[model samples]
Target: MMQVKSVTRIFGQKAALDDVSFAVEKPGFVGIIGRSGAGKSTFLRVMNRMTDATSGSLMFDDRDVLALEGGAKRAWQSQCAMIFQQFNLVPRLDVVSNVLHGTLNRRSTLASMFGFWPDDDVLKAFAILERLDIAEQAAKRAEALSGGQQQRVAIARALMQDPKVILADEPIASLDPMNAQVVMDSLRRIHDEDGRMVIANLHTLDTARRYCDRVIGMRDGRIVFDGTPDQLTTGVARDIYGADASFNEGATSTAIETLGTEGDDAYAQSMMA
Candidate 1:
């Protein structure tokens, strides 16, 4: 179980995360939704130890996450792996090599720096790529794959960490609707098959509704709602996104269709290039 207690992250006078408290008692897919600057990304970062909370406590299965230092902190970070919007792969490296980077925490610094991956680690990377349905692309350059494929490779990398929790910060924010669906499917599959805790900061309510087992709504750095997807009614969405917000189903569908068309255009352009 992961527990967050009165966690507040203050940036100067601004409180990015204000008195936030929550607990994840079991493994499931969780979606964190909010408008920009609602502290969605900040909260994920604090959980992964990418950023510190100015006050309060974070505990993961009895370990004091906020109090960890040095190697203990590094271990905690590895256990709570993060996936980013940018797909954070080594553009020039092969996909398998990029996935292998996840094992750096468990290996000697000299071995990792020298690119000396053990045979078992290499085999594990292959298995992960296969599980993510990207085994054929394992030897290809990371930059050569489509956006969705790259994100799958990124997921493979995260799995190589054998993490207890996976935190994805807007993993599909840059992709087209088709690719977005693929990436979201991959995340859902991981959560279902592996039973690892998956928490994602998502922009689209539709995607959250489609994939997440639980939805958490935030507004003005505070949690506005927390419940199952069915519990997030249109009225509750209005409260989360504000009365003037345009994040309804109709608007979301239009945006997704537009993004899908744009992604097709970009793919065609890349092929011509």
Candidate 2:
């Protein structure tokens, strides 16, 4: 479980996260939705300690990640890998090499300091690529693959670390519709297949309704809403965004009236409404 206690972040005179608090049970899939500058990305970064809050505490599984020091912090970070909006891969490195990078933690003093390591995990890295369905590009440079494929590579790199929590900050924001589906499907499959905790930040309400088990809405650096997809409605969305939110599927908290193959038929009903 992860507990965020009255977390707040300030940027000079402006508040980025204003006393936000939430507790996420482990092994659950969650989606965070908010407009730009709503502190969505900042919240995710706080999980991995990529950014520090001006005050407040964050705890995971009975451990205070922020208090950890030296190798303890490094070990905790290795167990929680983050995937960003951009595919932050070594563009010139082969996909296999990038995945092997996840194993850097296992290296010893001379090996790490001198940039040397034990036997390469090329075979294991190859297996991760195969699981992500991007094995065919393992020998290829990271820059050569398509946008969706590169994102998958990034995911595989994270998996190679065998993380307990996966924090994705807008994993599909850079793709087209087709590519977005591919990436979302890949992420969804990761949770369903491995039962790993997936926390993704999304811009579209429809995507939240379609993929997440529960949606958390943030406004002005505070969480304004948190509930199952079926709990969403126009009124709820209006509070999250505004009156125009109803017309913009990207901003609404869509209520999943029926848990079907692809959730409720909001498309047909809302379009007619």
Candidate 3:
């Protein structure tokens, strides 16, 4: 379980996160929904310790996440992996090599810097790529794949950490509709299959409804609403986006359904094999 108590982050004179408090007691897909500068990214950064909270407590399971230091802090970071909007892959590196980078915290610094991964670590990378249905692209350059595939490769890298929580910061913000569906489907599969906590900063109401088990609505550095997808009604969306908001279907139902079918096909192939 992750417990955040009265967490506030201040930048210079402004408070980016204002006394935010929440708890995640179960493993599922969680969506943080808000407009630009609603503090969604800041909140995720604080959770992962990418940015320090000015004040408050962050407890993950038995450890005080906010109090961790030195090597312990580095280990904590590995346990709570982050996925970025940019995919963050080395464009020149092969996909498998990129995924192997996830094990850096556990490997020898000199060996990792030289790209000398052990056989077992290489196998683990292959397993993660297979799980993501991108194993065939293992030897390809990270930049050679499509946007959605690159995101999946990024996810594979995160999984190599064997993280307890995956914080995705606006993961599909730059993808096309079909690619967005594919990425969301991959995230859903990870949560459903691995039972890992997946918290994503989502940009659209439709995407949240389609992918997340819970939606957290934020406005101006404060949480405005927290509920299940069904509870996120049009009225509540207006409250989150504003009265003059025009919410469009970011990913059409047809696109998501098609992606679902593709996932089913992959599952069937795995079963057959």
Task: Give the best candidate by TM-score.
Answer: 1
Backbone collisions counted per model: 0, 0, 0
Instruction: State, as a TM-score between 0 and 1, how close model 3 is to the true structure.
Output: 0.88
Over 27-66, each residue of candidate 2 has an lDDT whose tens digit, in order, gives 8789987665667877777667777678888888898886
User: What is the lDDT, from 0 to 100, of the residue 258 in candidate 3?
Assistant: 26
Off by over 4 Å in 2: 108-120, 243-273
lDDT, candidates in the order shown? 0.84, 0.77, 0.83
Over 4 Å off, model 3: 243-273
Report the lDDT of model 1 for residue 100: 99
For residue 73, model 1's alpha carbon misses the true position, in angstroms, by: 0.5
Candidate 3 achieves a global lDDT of 0.83
Candidate with more favorable, higher lDDT: 1 or 3: 1
Q: How far in Å is the alpha carbon of 264 misplaced in model 2?
A: 31
